[model samples]
Target: MSLRPNPPCLNPQTPPPPQSELDNIRRYDVKAIANYYRRRPWKVLGRALEVLWSFGFFLTCLLWDQWTHQVEYYKRQRAEDLRELLTKLGPTFIKVGQALSTRPDLVRRDFLEELIKLQDQLPPFDNDLAFQLMEEQLGMKVDEAYREISAHPVAAASLGQVYRAMLFSGEEVAVKVQRPNLRPRLSLDLYLMRLGAEKFGRFLPLNLGHDLTLIVDEFGIKLFEEIDYLNEGRNAEKFAENFHGDAEVKVPCIYWQYSNQKVLTLEWIQGFKLTDIDKIRAAGLDPSNIIKIGVTSGLRQLLEHGFFHADPHPGNLFATLDGRMAYIDFGMMDQLEPGTKETIASSIVQLINKDYLALTEDFIALGFLAPNTDITPIIPALENVFGSAIGQSVQDFNFKTITDDFSELMYDYPFRVPAKFALIIRSLVTQEGLALSLDPNFKIVEVAYPYVARRLLTGESPQLRRQLIDVLFKNGKFQWQRLENMLSIARSDTKFDLLPTAQLGLQFLFSEEGLYLRRQILLALTEDDRLHTDEVQRIWGLVKDDFRPQELVNVAWNAVREFSLAGVSTILPQR
Candidate 1:
């Protein structure tokens, strides 16, 4: 793709947000909120009454359904009622419903099926107001800027709605306009929710190991980010950069000239929702392959880039005509702190290795367990919870099932998801749900393990290199099959190169960290005081087909070149 200095937009001079909208961009602050609402007691009272009334109505309907349990009929009816209630309750509750949809542990299966609809089924605001705001933010009349625009929103989401439009230049685009007065309403609901979580959270019939208030606060922060169209535009650009040359993934470009705090314009995509299996198949695309792109791309985001779209529901993802998984709505994106990504990757390795003790420590290190908390009791619980779930094959391992069991374990123990990891869990769970929609028997780990294996095999970082060693060697014994398995899996990835992997292996085998590994290799080869060349011959036999002699020579030459460059650079003066 060719780079442009400044992509033109409908409005060359988009207006900045007013003072009121600017105030909404601030971080979540409970003290400031309480103080701000102190002088507006009437507003608080009115919203509180409204919330209570809505909850009462929802509960009454649920109770009535329970009283008349007419087999499977009422069950579906109850789920529908819950979906409608959340829709009526507005965006904050809608978001909560979306989160609950991914938690098989919290919601019944039927309700989960219904709640997922909330992702894009919310009602849109007035068309007149939406168009007017689009004009006002862009500083250009709608007709003058766009040759044609949709009469109604193409899709209505919790925070905003998308309209398909065409520019005067005949370029197709998607114009996303935020709902008017969204900030104040969301802020108020979040404040009220936070207050309730602080005051009466414990009394609820819930077993989350963390403070509910913190979760509310985190949600509030992301909600604020989502409302800011400019922030989301920047997020989109960054995400695009992260997957710059990746063929399997696509991210829409932001037209900055026509975008501001409340208005966003981007490339319009003609595609099918990931859940639309029939449409996907009709388009000559394989649903399973589309899911693979989604899973692999998701893994790259969380593991490699440490930046990811936290909200990846069906509506926000689409299977493009060209077989690329396009990600939309960059709002609600999160960044993993340094080392956190490696820790997560290591946990996956530990899980596959069935080292429950190490996995328990990984949780503590990841902040799922509080410091100074005793973990002796937790290790066995984790083992028992995951052992049966991970049964014969990774292909049959379901993430939701593990989380369901994990929720019980968390309730019994002091396992709490850190605020930082809340969205991580939600994103992963939602991605898994999306995959299951396309392929019923899909296992997240089936795709995830291959990606992890590829990373472990060729990763240059010391931490990842150490993990590679950990996978290959167990209890000071060299595991030939483990090495063979990793190589087999890693080679399956398109980006995997055998020569570089072998080069890294040789480099590490001689490095300081490899001292223990070298000792193990020597011990294995000299077992019973007799040199055994069988294992070495076996590994060579496995890789000989792909590891060409020319590639080995190239690896040697490149290593020499790198070493020479390093020596020369060290002796030269600092810039």
Candidate 2:
């Protein structure tokens, strides 16, 4: 993908030209270009000073070996200072810090903890400038577009501020007005960031597994998309379509007539923040159910819909009075390719079944391991990490331990998380943390199991069906233990009907390969001399109960007759 500059829009009233026409357009923002050159020196100096100050503390701690005990204290202090510096640097750096908070591979836990608190809340821009931009972009006066508009912003953030307004038709809406000259400022900042990233990749001790240039380029694209209010409006519409008729989730409707490149008008959702458990409970709502709905919806986006809300923090989510999850700020969204989704679903199944070998294969398939890499070394490591949780219920499993262990393994192995996978992990971890705060006993896996199982049981994917069969059948024979575990998990959810799963299994059994599998089971039963009479009877009873088809029953009878004849001959003995 080439990184061509986006053409400047000379007239905000007209729609921006498409990518094909960008090269033909000669529009330019001379003011933005001059401003960039004027501010470049000061911005560079400020960043240098901030970096020097941050590293100065660390160097002092290192050189003064006598103050070793204070090393940790100084390290924490430096991290806090770096976070403050990023916050002070403005919108671009704040976003960078927010992205860094999600990357456990790049930073330590203390730094991550501090960086995650970097809020995007900023003081509102001048109200007059906001109103003027709205009018200029929407090609209408503020009053013509809305019946009533707040003189002050209802909420202020890094890139935009939202005002409560009523449309001309009396529909209450939220108007998000972009920060003045954000496009030019962001372009300049991202250009500098890209240069810095290239330098860091050359000098820093990091193994990113990919080009830093590409990563920065991708980040720049996403940031630019976020600043495009029309893009955000379309994202909201896509989400609304995705969740149409979903009673537990709600997406704000967009008013396109009053929206433009720099100004977005959306249905204003009146609800409490998701973290306001006390207030939610006061309104006769169950916080646990709310979290459950959020988890399920998030899982569906990842596993079923392929598109997900990448930033689902408390601020971006709300618990409405109608008991539906209202998601706002559709600026950051991630899409999972079909192949990635398949790998994820298969990984979940393998984790549930405790299939370490299959899990290793999944990692390899997902590009976490090289194709030529020997997975034998990793299998024992996986066992060491997940063995304790093998037979435990989802509620009893420790998700933190798994994540920690995985982090450790990444340090030891050739594992690198792609940007999309990283976002998915970050979103889930953040959501899980929120859910835990709401209900200490909440188990994310417990809520996600039904969805995973439903996909495996009913999905049309042949690869997934093969994985399901692999989970249920081992060594060419049906594994009752694994089957029972799956059935138990399925039964745990009252809404999940096991009939479809049973039918799927039976359909497979009656297939040609399944007939061969039946023969393998018969051979195993007949050849095992340790089987006593009672044991044989129990096995026969189980087979008869499960395999109702006459061909299967006949095969079982023949195997039993041959075994009995062999037993009599052995007892009569002469051999």
- Per-residue alpha-carbon lDDT of model 2 for 18-129, expressed as tens digits? 4332222122333443355455687656655665676576567556644666656566776776677676666787788877765665678888777867644456789999
Candidate lDDT scores, in order, read 0.81, 0.71
Write down the lDDT that model 1 would get: 0.81
Highest TM-score: give the candidate number.
1
Q: TM-score for all predictions? A: 0.92, 0.78
Candidate 1 lDDT tens digits, 185-250 = 787888889989999999987766778887888888898888888889889889988988888887
- TM-score of structure candidate 2: 0.78
Candidate 1, pairs of clashing residues: none
Best of the candidates, lDDT: 1
Q: Tell me the TM-score of model 1.
A: 0.92
